[model samples]
Target: MLPRRFNLHRPDRIEDAVALLAEHGDDASPYAGGTELLIAMKARVLSYAHIVDLKGIAALRGVSARSDGGLIIGALTTHHELANHSLVLERLPAYALLSANVANIRVRAAGTLGGNLCFAEPHADPPAMLCALNAELVLAGPGGERRMLLAEFILGELSTARATGEVLVRIEVPGLPAGTRAGYRAFGHLERPAVGVAAVALPLGKGFDWRLRVGSICGRPTALAGLEKAMRGLPEADALAVLAEGAEQAAAAVEADDDIRGSAEYKRHLVGVLARRAARAALGMEALAA
Candidate 1:
């Protein structure tokens, strides 16, 4: 099926794009990589009379290092670019690996990070890791720019906190402390993950600061707060035991729904398995063969 007829407007500036969105109101959408939007439009699941193309806005592209030893990634950047970019590979190789495996090569080539988040598909991968890394989103609007934690930006499945005319400009990942390591694990069928987990381990003397996030099995990414609290101050070996033992209980606390992907029980099981694997990977342990 063909997308309903629409007028495409290319705006070179962020303000201009916001203006177009504001002017059209609900009739328009800010277009980046059209991967998700185009699919919905083509299926007639969504219809927009005006499409505000943001690709012409040069400010929304590229990967650069931050003075704080973190990263600033343009929202409009493609997954393929991120996977191969030097700074991304050097600073957050786990993220780079995740980007490299998103869907297929074609989607990675054309899909933009901003689009993926704005679309807010529950089965997507980036949100989990971004949340674990404590990433923040910078949004541009007629009122000027406002920033929020990425975890707060996503309201639920297929929904977000973006206002009427706000445009997501960039994603900010804070620097990890020395000796910090991060890892991500996801399992699924079709092209999307059924359950994805991201783990970050920051050394705190002999103990560790553990951040864990589980995604795709629920409406939005869920932090394993219970497990994190239990493992936070434990020695390396003890922490691993806590994580391995508590993973299933922690996963069961999150509400998983039955879907075409799998039964809620199965997804919860996957969550536990992946969470333990991700935490181990973050601790520089070897991956166990399937």
Candidate 2:
């Protein structure tokens, strides 16, 4: 059971939610699906006197296609809903696949996309995938709404660009071109291979336009730009070699934390391997597109 002393406030509108957050400020935590927040509270890792529940706010839920052929996903949209959405499956198939694999049915049923992104856990899957697709975050605060790229939004381990009195309202992902193909792959621990090092790759055009992002191995999910640059103007074999080199460089650039899952070095190596595999899959998609 949850603590009895904490107060819960359910706001019906976005303005009210923002007002409550501004009023309570640091003392109040915005509750989405309550999957991570409740668990953290139970473990004593996070404490808040008041909980601002976002569920009643209808503005923060749903998925719809934008006028520009992109997709806008509200903060309260659950993982299960995302995984099953026909528009998401048609427009962003790789993300749908990744969403379907997060934890299991129960967790997926309770977890919200914005909540997952807000948590910014290194092992989490969505941020990396979002980064791969070049997703944008829309935040609303007292100062008004502002947008930031996915990479900027997720700064480091368990940290985000979200400031006090700000709410992450939605994520906007632009549509990919006709030749684009993206894929997500990972290797988990011996006991839990399902949750291991997750990597995502997006192939744009044939030569230099391919993009890649890898997550769940480093402190923050990162775009593999250096690797993508190295692969540019190269043939498939050369691109693969460049990708491996870029993975090494990326591993060196970030400090992968060691935990119950594996050691730092082990995680780095896992990222490297998964990066290569993801790169190869992306190349295969490119070939099919060609």
Candidate 3:
């Protein structure tokens, strides 16, 4: 149960929400779907005097196509909606797959993409996948609306660039070229294998271009840009070697922790393995068609 003394503020408009946040500052926490926030509150990890629920605001829901052939997902759209949306499945299958695998059916039903990102859990899935797809985050606050890359938005573990009154409005994923295919993979614990080392990969242009993001095992999901760079213009054998090298480099860069789930060394190894598997799956799909 949540703390009894706290107040709940349900604003009908985004402006009102911002005003409340600006006025109350740290005392007020913006509530999206509340899957993580509520749980944290119950666990006493988060304590706030007032809750600004964003669900009643109509602006924070739905999935729509952008003019640039990408997608604009509202902050409050539930994981269930994203996983099953026709447009999402057709165009951004990587995201759809990631959404489906976030947790069990009930958690997916209750969790919102915005809430997941806002929580910024080190083991979260969406952030890394968004980074792989080169997604951007839109924010609204007292200073006015602005956009930032996903990498920039997630500054560190359990942290973001959102200021005192800023709220994430939506996430925008730009279009990919034709002949692109994407996939997501994860290795969970024995009892919950689905939540462990998660990886997403995208292959484009008849396999000429590729990208992959690995999450859920480190402090944050990391984009394999170095791997993508090394694989550019290389043949299959050379590309695989480059990918492995890049994975090693990325693993080296990660600052993981020794948690109940696994040791830091194990998590780093998981990242490398998942990265290779995801990349291979994406590239293998391309090979089968050719």
Compared with the true structure, all predictions reach lDDT values of 0.91, 0.75, 0.75
Better of 1 and 3 by lDDT: 1
Instruction: For candidate 1, write residues 188-258 as lDDT tens digits.
Output: 98679999999988888688999999988877899999999999978988999998899989988988999
Winner by TM-score:
1
TM-score of each: 0.98, 0.88, 0.88
lDDT of 2 by residue, 1-290 (tens): 45435789999988788888899889888999888899888877788888999999898999999877779999999999998999998887767877887777888998999999998876777877788777899999988999999889888878999998888899999876665656667667532232233333334345446566667766676666676666765666777777766676666655666778888777777767777776666556432111
**Model 2 residue 285 lDDT score:** 43
Quote model 3's TM-score. 0.88
lDDT of 3 at 14: 92
Kindly report the root-mean-square deviation of model 3 from the true structure over all alpha carbons.
3.3
- What TM-score does structure 1 among the candidates reach? 0.98
Q: Which 10-residue window in model 3 sums to the lowest lDDT?
A: 191-200
